[model samples]
Each structure stands twice: as C-alpha cells, then as structure tokens.
Target: MDYESLYKLIPKEPKKWLTQDVISWLQFIGLGQMEQKFVECSIDGAVLEDLTEKDLDEELGITQRIIKRKLLNWVNHGLKEYNEYIKQMKMPNLNNKKQQDEDFTIQKNIANSQFEQMLIENHENNGNDQFTSSVVRQEEQAIKQEIPGFNKFEHQLILQPIEGQQSNFYCVREAGAKIGRHSSNQILILEENISRFHAEIIFQDSMFALKDIGSTTGTFIKILKSLTLIQGMLIELGSNQFSVQKLDLLDNGGIEISLFVVEGPNLEDTIIFQLNKDKPSVALGRKSTVDISFPEDHHLSNQHAKFYLVDQTVTIEDHGSTNGSWMRLSGEGKMSNLFYLDPNEEIIIRIGTTNQYICQQNKMKVNEISGENLCIICVERERDCLILPCKHNATCLKCSKNLALCPFCRVKIQETIRIYKN
Candidate 1:
C-alpha cells in the first residue's frame, strides 16, 4: 500500500496518535507485535521473509484471536478516516461547480471576494508574492475603506478642482485633480486623472442622463446645484453597482465641471464623467486646497508598512505607472522601489498628489500572537493556521466540540460555537 494512503489510514492528529483504533490498524496491517520486534520493524518498512498466523502472533507476543480482532478494527478505522477526508476535500470544488450550474450568482460573489482579496494582497505586497499578515491588513484596510459602516451609507471627497496648475495627473489613483473655470461659459471644468477615476457617463436625450462611478473602494458624487435635480446629493457606487438619472454637461464651462471620486477601486472603477445641462456660471473658488502629493508624514507610512498581523507574506507587481511606489524595510535604506516583497518588508507608494499611501507597520509581537482570542481550524499539517475574528480556532472539528472556551484565550463562549465548513 502507498505510504500516503497509510498516512491517511492512520489519524494524522497527534492527539489521536496512539488510540485503540490506531493499534487495531497496525494489527490489521501485520505490524502488531506478539514479540514487539515485528511491530517495531513494520513501522520502519522491514518484514519477515516467511509469514504465518503463529509467526505474526510470535512477532506481536500476543494471541492469534487478539491479533485478528485488532487487525479488523484497524482496517475499519482506516477506512472511516479515509472516507471522511475524501468527503471533506470534495465539498468546496463540488459546491463551486454546482453553483456554476445554478448560474454562478453566488459563486461569482464568493469569487469576487476572493479576487478582491488577491488584488488587495497584490497591492500590499506590490503584486510579487502571496498574502501575509501585513498584506492581509492592507487588504482588510482597503476593504474597510471601501465598505465602512455596515448600516447606513457614507460620503467622501473624490477630487476638488485645481486651477492653473501645471501638474501631470498620472492616471494612477494618487495623482492630483484639475479644475478649470471657463470665464465666458461660466462653468466648472473638472478634469480627473482619467486612469485613476472611474465613472460611466450615459448620454441621454442631451438633457437627462446618469453617472455610475463603479469602484471596489468607493466613488462619491456631491451635486452643488440646488435645482433639486442636482445639488448636495451624495451618490455612492459599490463594485458593479450603478447610478441613474441626472443632467448633461455639454454647456457648463467649456465642459461641465463637477467633482468625481477617482482611483478608489481596481481597473473597473474608472468610468467616463457625463454631466447634463450645460449652463454658464462664473468659476467658484475651490473650498479645498490643491495639493500635489499625499500626506508624506503619516505614521502609517513606516518602513515596515507591509507588516500585516494576519496571514503573512505577499507578492507585488507595478502597473507601469509614472512615479513608482516602493518598500522601506526597517534599517535597510531611506526608500527603495520594489516590484516584489518578502514576508517582513513594508510598503509605500509614491504619488503625484500630496496624499501619502503610508501604511503602519503592525507588530507581530508575542502579545499580539498570544493575545489572540478565537478558535482556529488547522488543516495543513505542514503550515500554521491563523485565527480569524470568528470564534473558530486551529484544531480539528472533533477536538473543537470538546472545548468550552476559545482555545487561545480561555474566554467563555458558553452558548455559542463557531463551525467552519469547507
């Protein structure tokens, strides 16, 4: 029999290492000892040239009836564990295929979550590695920023028009915004780094239309018009969501100038700006200042920026944008550009605007690691598992049921137990 098959035949768990079932399995495999030497030898792959029931009994120093009973039990136990593992492994793929057959709506949602996680990890690790704790924190931060506040909606600024500035707006989300006031037309002309901002401008009847700014992060629209049709109303677009019904911008300024949130989501978040109803209005002074860079001094911009406290390690990839990003390792150098990342490095992005894409280096201190308060499910024997916010911890399902408190913290979750499905 294959060693791998045998490995599965025996419980992989150390806690179950010497159970009666396991002993029985060894007996069935002819590894049980009447004399102890046969059992010892069998474990190391050595065996006798000739075999008989008495020989086996002699080898185990046990009676034939006892050996036979243990052997049968061993085979049964091995089969049970094998069947369980097979069932568990097949569930996820089978569920995915079944979801596909059912039109993939739910599967797509799950896929998108996984995809967004991948993209976020790529950004965190600069797209050169898999996710680590540092990378996961960045992704979780991105997710938090994208979908903050579970209950009601929220609004934020995208770009305030910058006038008479000779700055290059790299379509890479962090670039600054440009706004121009056409004196003769009396309209605000807002120009965003087309690469960073995302919008969908629908041309409707030249008078009425809609604008949906799809983004993974988020897009906000604040209408300054009191015409009831377009003023002070906040429009938000989620990933793949839409916005409908609005005015056209053919006549406002040389072009209609309106503020649009840019560079929040991934590539799909960028869309065209379409404003309806072109009206001549004098340039309104910007209520906000125009900066050419993100905040450079934020503490989050530490050299160990990618030190996520969650799953560790990640890869990075640059999208070939101007003003490249970099990673600053602690005690390494002032700042260095990178196309990839190791487990311990931090991340930093250079942008054209005053905003600094600085991420704080989360410490994986002993307290943080040991202070964690949840149940974890460890699946891979070769790798360590992390505990998520859910009450699950790293252990087999069978072991988990016997515990009352969170395994890591000993906090009593008396009436509740979190179950993880494949």
Candidate 2:
C-alpha cells in the first residue's frame, strides 16, 4: 500500500480500524519495517489510539530515540485530529434542533467526500427519482464544492492533438474506471499503439489498484520496495529501460542476473557484477560507482534501486530514488498492481504514448554489451567515449571514432567527448 493512502482511510475512524489498517498507518509514518513488533504486541487500532511515546520503547521495543519520536509525533497528531473531529460532531436533539452538516469534512474532507457522495447518490437514485430539480440543486449548494483543476476527469482520456503528449492525472473514484484506447472505454486514449482494453484501475477498501487487461504495450509501475525478479521483463529506471543481459548460477545455489542496458545513457560505464553468497545484491543509479549507472539521467538518485538474488528467489527493491524505478507488468491473471495512492501526490497511470514505443524492442538492432565496463564493440578495452546529445558512454574511443550510432540506446552520435582517467 502506498503510505499516503492511509490518510484517506482516516475517515473510517481509528477505533474501528483493524490490524492491517494499523499496519497501513505504520507505513504512512514510515515505520512499516518495525510492524512485526506491532503485530507481536497485537496493537490494533483501538490500542494504537491510546499508545504513548513511552510505550514505543517500553512496550514495542523500538529503541531508536529518533524513530520513537517520529512515531510519537504521528500518533499524537492523528489523535488530535480524531479528537477534534469527535468534539465537533453534534447529534440532533430529537427533532428539537436543525440537522447538523454531518461533519463530513472531519472525515474524508469535503472534496473527496462530496465527490463520493455524488456518485453514491447518483447510483442510488437511478430508478427512484422522487426529489424535485430544485431540491437537487439545493442539495448541491449545501455539499457540492469542486477544487479547480481538481476534477478534470480523473480517468477520461482527453482527445490528444498532433504534436506531443502530456501526463494524465486520474481522479480517485468509488466506481473505479476502465482505461484503454477504445472509444467505448471509461478512460480512452487515441494512441493506436495502446490496446483497446489496456487496463483497469479499481477502488476497493478505500484504496486504488491498477491491473493490466490484455494490452500489447503493457503497463509498468515503479517498485516502491521489492518485486519477484523475472528474466526478459523490462525495468524502467528513468528515461530508459533495461532487461536481463545474463543470468548466472551462484555457488550458494542462488542466481546472479546482469542487466542489459536496453535504452539509456550508460554512466556506470559497465553493469557487470559477480553475485555470490558474499554479494547477493546489484545496485543501479546515476552514480558512477553504482553497479549499473546512468549518471546523466538525473531522474535517478546516487543509488536508485537494487536487485537481490536470494538462495531460492530473485527480487528488486527501490533504494530511495527521486523519480522512482519501474517494472513492466504482465496482463490480467492476478490483481497485478495494487495502487495505494498517496493522497499527497498525483495519481498517474502511465501507459505513455503507446504507438511511439510499440515497436521499440523489436526494432532495436541490439549490439548487446559483452560484460560490465567493457567496450561495446571489442568487449575488452575500456568504454571511454561520451557520445554527445545522448550523453551515452558505452564504446571505447577506438571503437567509437567510426561509429555512427551510440551503442547504448542507438541514438545518432552527433559529437564525441573523451576524458582520460588515470
């Protein structure tokens, strides 16, 4: 679950929350790693509401002073909000007073609540339309308030004109939405590259999740933490994409996978690693020292993410990146993607401009890398030339002199830059 999703759930009230809800809240406060202790202590929502800072160290065994303070602050702030909400909730005095405004803002806030209320009322009043038009208008006046640019059709695909495409922001809906290029779809894109029924984003249990239908281009999302690694599957780090170049069996019965820089600037120089029991991980980022680097792709952090080759399994994890790392998702079988939107950030289901990349992998005249840090052509000498425009460095100065295409991403080499390193 995305941490911010928990904030939307605060409307459910703390006392009525379950164990998973408490766990979700822990992630919201960035203390999800220590939740086993919370589970061991059987700290449900009711108990969590009363938990004080002292109880963290004394009862939950969270010894780190800073962590305890952070958790304490989150708990206290949340309780304060809940308490204030309860105090303001006025119950009608048995027909002796006017009906109160339901204190809805105290819960999901007026924006989210009213939107949902409109949907629910629309659905409920479908057949039985007894209310007058004036009554409906009056009801809207009392409850309807839209945040400007807020409800610009969360999932509806706007007609795109020729030129370039822009980012699509979706509204969190109770009815959920179907996304695709089909004219009949709830969310539609005109890109011919996108499949007719590309994917679906559903809202369940007060959170949103994305699932691929049967799209050809595929849906991809960044790894917030870990993913069961698969060979051939593409991983998007920033402006580029990658896949398995080589997979080797380790002495410890685990497996090591070397990533093929499919499309991007190679800043790490090489993306080769020996993953034995001693080194069960491979790191990737824009930092030169990273196992696989794309130094020019500022969207990445020093260490964007990691690939863990365990004894029986392989997994990938996000190492606190700026733009985040992504993994391509396969079409419908399992839920595939559970998107817990952080109410703090915009919710984007990025199918991208599908047609532009539909033939990307197929058309690549791949000059696959021989090993990490080696020349793209000779596979022996150091790759030392920085191809201009793309900022890619995958070919040795000797090999790149006559090269027309930058070996990493196949972008035409316009100019060359070579800095000798001792």
Best by lDDT: 2
lDDT of 1: 0.29
TM-score of each: 0.19, 0.40
Candidate 1, residue 246: how far the Cα is off, in Å? 84
Give each model's whole-structure lDDT: 0.29, 0.56
Residue-by-residue lDDT tens digits, candidate 2, 137-219? 63564453232431221221111111225223222234567767777777666777677888776656545566777676667
Tens digits of per-residue lDDT for model 1, 90-154: 45565454423322332233334445646655686674545465457645644543443522211
Q: How many clashing residue pairs appear in each of the predictions shown? A: 74, 4
Distance (Å) between predicted and true CA of 396, model 2? 64
Regions of candidate 2 where Cα sits further than 4 Å from its true position: 1-177, 190-197, 200-217, 264-270, 330-349, 353-422
Q: State the number of backbone clashes in model 1.
A: 74
lDDT for residue 279 in candidate 1, whole number 0-100: 20
